[model samples]
Target chain A: MTADLFLQILVSGLLIGLIYALVAVGLTLIFGVMDIVNFAHGEFLMLGMYASFWGFALFGIDPILSMPVTAALLFGVGVLVYQVIIRRIINAPMLSQIFATFGLMILFRGLAQFFWKPDHRLVTHTLVGGNVTLGSIQFGLPQLTAAVGAVGVTAGLWYFLHRTRLGTALEATAIDREAATLMGINGQSMFALAWGIGAACAGIGGALIATFFPIFPEVGSNFILIAFVVVVLGGFGSIVGAFWAGIIVGVIEVVGGFVVGPEYKTAIVLSLLLLVLLVRPKGLMGKA
Target chain B: MTTIHLPKTVGALALLGFALLLPLVIQDPARQNFLILILMGAQLGVAWNIIGGYAGQVSLGHAVFYGIGAYTSTMLSLKLGLSPWLGMLAGGVVASAFSVAMGWPCFRLKGHYFAMATIAVAEIVQVLVTNSETLEGAVGLSLPMGNTGVAAMVFSTSKLPYYYIILGLLVVTVLASWAIERSHIGYYFRAIKDEPEAARALGVSLTRYKLVAIAVSSFFTAMGGSFYAQKEMFIDPGSVLATGVSIKIALIAILGGVGTLLGPVLGAGILITIEEYSRVLFGSTGSGTDMIIYALMIILVAVYSPAGVMGLLHELRRRIPSLRAKAEVRA
Candidate 1:
């Protein structure tokens, strides 16, 4: 392969990596603070795609313009889901929490199919066109936009989580929910906020992904597995870890898919995950 | 335990006799197929319950093991002229060893992480099956049925043989489950299920017992796959080892009662019946009937009774002890 083709693949990979970071960041946050691995996190991304799809078709809006509204809408839904369904089982049992999210995933996916049909919903006409050709490498406009958007959103959230009071409160709740309560902080609210914000990140990621990729009923499932691998590989609860891991994962997926047929790539990624997990169970960015 | 109280061995024999005679009584091909499917499901549920129900592993990937058994048995018998009856046993062994191979690395993570790991494992297996040149690469392998005596298990022409075969499997599975329930290993499994760290501290080896559960559970599960392959007379990776397949098997265990013996079987019977009815109604091919039935079962069981259908029955029987007493006297 020519150097230009190599540059093109790498650029595409880095662009996709940014999107992976956006999606995984929320999972990292929820895991970091709440220690709850919401198995239905992927379904939220599915809903976000549906939201963006409707936002464009019904309202005649651009994806970038509809991004915040899409994020906020899912944000509220996340808080509601947590308050109504999650709160009841927060202390019930591990299986209950696991199954509850699973059930909700089924429920949400069912709803999506019921309402939207199982067809690929996309914003084809309004797609950002034009390619940037630099040093014999072609970088598309959509790729550039998604990459920039992902990085900007990630940085903004990083600043918010690390610098803001609410961020510290979220971190405190994650550290110890009961202790945070004893310290006169509303741990419940923080959890709700964390899930809400995390969901927003998923929504934005979904919207961004839908720009270049097709959206099907089980599309989120495709990303969900890879995201899980990324999360596990990067570290269970580190945003920075998720960031780097996402990029590394994006590169590996593309490179591995190219080198060893698409079928073997999943095995490679999962085997990598298992290896990392066995060697370092605490995760890449996770504290031992 | 029933109206005619006999020796345990005799009672078991009588039940087997009844099952063997089912094809004779139910001459209708459809009913025979349903019965065979139920028996197959019952066997599978028992297999899944050993690890998922008894050990509380909640693997959403047992179908891969099942697929391994089915494919191995079919391939060896067709290619090497091995007896499928023997091939099935070998298939079971292969699956059990594979389970142990996977269990070593995966048993470290708990709950969702473990579940995802299993999912990944199954997906990788599916990919392997799909990509392998030997396996025919997605188009799948075709094996001739009923060639030389008992060499090939290709007797899907009549539902009677399948009924007997699955019935035999169901009996073996029940016996295995009963043995596990009464064994010391069963207690260690329960300990691991309810309290892992405490069990670990109290001299119980988590990995050892967990692997045992997985191996035993997978052995039967793989056998169920073989039985299914024999009955269907066609073996393919997609039919046996898909994500939906694992999810369905897990649902069967969850539906009946994960920990209790016979719960998953009961659940599987009901679930299979529902699925058959749905197929009859909706004519297969992603008909929403299965989803509707599954959703209802999940919701009702999850909300009203988290312990599942058998657990609900136990609770109801407890609440109305007079009904239990009357039943005992009637028996």
Candidate 2:
């Protein structure tokens, strides 16, 4: 590949990796807080994309303009899911937790299909409508904006967790539920907040990507496997790890696809996951 | 533990006998097909239970073995002109070998991690199959039309032979599970499941027993896949190797009663019935309704009774004194 081509692929990989980071952060946070994997997380991303698509199609609102609304909608959904389904299985066995979330995933996907129909929809016209070129490399404006949005959201989340009292409480609960309870943190509320934030992150990621990618009920499945790889390779329950891992996975997927074959990209990413799991189960940034 | 419960044993035998004779009595091809599906579900569930239920591995990528079975037998029949009967055995062996390779690395992880690893492995298998030209890639393979004989394991339209074939497979799987439950190997499996560290301390080789369980589980699962291929007269990666198929196998076992001898059989019967009826009721327009119902059932079962339908029955029998005596009398 030419240097320009390599740079192009690298930049594209980096942009997509940011979105993957956003999705993985939500998953990691949920897993960290409750020890539940939240298999329905990808469906939440799917919902976000659909939300953005509807906002654009129905109201002529650009996805970039309606990102917050989509995020809020997904936030409510996340909390509702936690309240209705996850709360019941909070203390159940590992298997029950896995299946409960897996079931919810199926339910959400089914509902999405039932309500929206199965056709793939896209928001063709967006605020970021054109491509930008610099030094013989061209890239979509929508992708750059989405990457910026991802970084901004990640920074905001980091600030909330580190600089805010409520966020600290949430982290406390995640670290040690019983100890946090003794320290007067409301475990239930913290759990809800984690779900809300997690869902919101995924929603924002989805909405941003909706500007460029096709929106469909099963779109989440395509990204979810990569997100899982990111989470595991980064370290389960570690947000920072997931962020970095997401970028790494994206780079590998895009670069590997170009080098190998696009058809085997998923296999390449999954193989990396296996290799990471074998060599370092805790991930790069995860605590031992 | 080796001592069988007389009542349950007799009831199970009676059920088996009834199932064996079901095709003869039904006459309707549709009803017979449903029975075939039920038997298939039961066999898949039982196979999964060996590792997921007994050993507590909870693999979510079992469709890898199922796909391996289907692909192996189909390819053998299509390429080498081998009979599916022998192909079935070859498929089982191949699946078993693959399981060992998978289990060796994956068995080190506990609970959810192991499950995730299995999913990854299965995805890799799927991706490989989808990209390979030798396997016909995504277009898949169809059995030749001319061979509709017992020797080839392909039938034109009878459905009776297929029913008996799957039923026999189910019987073998259940009996194997039952025997394992009564044997020392079963004890080792339960030991590893309940307390791995303690089991290891007590001289039980965790890796060996876990490998053995998965091997047996994958072998039977592959056999079911081969049966599925021949019965359908077609094989595709999407049909045989999907993650959804893996979940269904585990779902049947969990819904019926994990680790119990007859739980998967019962679970299969209930689930297959719901699946078929929902498909019929919804038609093409009702794409997601059946899935919705199935998902709801899974959530309910997981939340309310982790032990499954058999567990609920056991609970009921325990609570009602008269029922307990009746159950004991039957035993």
Candidate 3:
């Protein structure tokens, strides 16, 4: 392959990888705090895509301009979901927890189909609507913007978690729920906050992906599996781990697809997952 | 534990009698097909229960074994002109071997990690199968229609043979489960599930027992898959290896009562009936109404009845004597 082509592939992979990181970040956050994997997580991304789409299609508001509203809307959705369903399953058996989220996944997909009519919607005309050419390599402007936006959001989340008092409390709660409770940290509220923020992260990622990708009820399924691979590759419940793992997965997917066949890309990524499980079950950065 | 309650035994025998005689009375092909579906579901669920329910390793990627069975049987018949009966056994053996291989590395991870790894492994297999040329790739495989009989295992004239075959399979699975439940291996499995560390402390080989559970589970699950391939006369990755299929199998076991011997059968009956009827009523609109109902049922069952339908029955049975005693006190 030509150097330019390789650079192009790398850039494309990086762009998509950033978005994957954003999505996995939310998922890892929720798992980190609550020890529950939200199978409905992809639906949050789907909802965000729809949020952006409706904003554009109905009111002619650009998706970029509506990003914050999408995030807020999804945050409320996350909190509502936790308060209604997740709260009850906090102490349920792992089997029940699995089914509860699995059921939620189906429920959300069904609801999306019922309300949105199962058709693929897109924000066809966005402000970032062109291509950027540089040094014999070309990139979609929307992809670049999405990647940049993803980085910004991830950075903001890191700042919140590491620098803020509320974030520290949430972190502490994640480390030891009982101790945090004893310290007067309301574990329930912390869980609620985690869900809200987690959903918000997916929403932002969705809004970014909405710029270049088609929006549909089943779109979340496409990303969710990849996000799972990323989460596992990065080590579940580790934010920094998810960030780098996402990029690595994305690059491997694109480059591997290019080298082998696009049909085998998922197989390649999933093989990596199996390899990681066999060699290092805790993942790259997961706690021993 | 081995002491059998007379009433329960009688009820079981009666149910078996009803199952054997129902097809003779009902001639409707669609209803017969529905019955076959329930049996198939129950078979897969029972097989899954060995590892998932008894051993407490929640493998969400069991469709891989099912698909392996289907493919193995189909390939044998299509390529070598072997009888599907032989293919069925071969499929079971192949699936068992595959399960052992998969469980070796996967058993190290606990809970969700193991489950997710299973999913990943199943997905990779599916992708590879879809892209494979020798296995016919996405085009799938079809059994020849020239021969029709018990030997061929293809019954186009009537659903009766298929029904009896699956029912027989289900009975064998249930009996195996019953035997295991009464055996020391079953105790080891339960100990591994409920008290892993203590079981390990007591010198129980957790991984070895886990592997045993998966091998047995996958063997039976493969038989069900082979049955499906024969009944449908077709094999495809989409049909046999989908993650949805895996989840459905596991859910049937969960919906009934995972560890209970007959729970999966009851679960399969309810779940398949609901699934089929809903599809008939609401599937054409493409509005996903059936999915909504299915989703709601799963959610409600998971949320309110974690112990499943069998657990509810046990609870009701426990309450009846107390209620009767209260009435006697009042009198």
Q: Score the docking of each candidate (DockQ).
A: 0.36, 0.76, 0.78
The fraction of reference A/B contacts recovered in model 2 reads 0.68
For model 3 chain A, give the 10-residue run with minimal summed lDDT: A279-288
The digit string of per-residue lDDT tens for model 1 on A1-288 reads 887778777877787777777788888888887777776788888888878878888987777789999899989989998887776666655555566667677667766665677787777755675677787777778777877877887788889877998887777787778888898899778988988998998998877766767777678777777777778878887888888888988888778887787778778877777677677766778765
Which residues of candidate 3, in runs, are more than 4 Å off? B1-6
Q: Give TM-scores of the second chain, every candidate.
A: 0.91, 0.95, 0.97
- Better candidate by lDDT, 1 or 3: 3
Candidate 3 docks at the CAPRI level of medium
TM-scores of chain A in all candidate models: 0.94, 0.98, 0.98
lDDT of 1 by residue, B279-302 (tens): 787666343445655665665555
lDDT, residue B117, model 1: 77
lDDT of 1: 0.79
Q: lDDT by residue for model 3 over A101-220, one digit each (tens)?
A: 899888888888888998887788999999999989898999899889878887888888899999999999889999999999999999999999999999998888999999988788
> Which tens-of-lDDT digit does each residue in B80-177 have in candidate 3?
98998999999999999999999998899888889988999899999999999999999999988888999999988899999999999999998898
What is the TM-score (0 to 1) of chain A in model 2? 0.98
Which sections of candidate 1 miss by over 4 Å? Answer: A1-3, B1-25, B145-151, B279-289, B299-304, B322-331
Candidate rank order under lDDT: 2, 3, 1
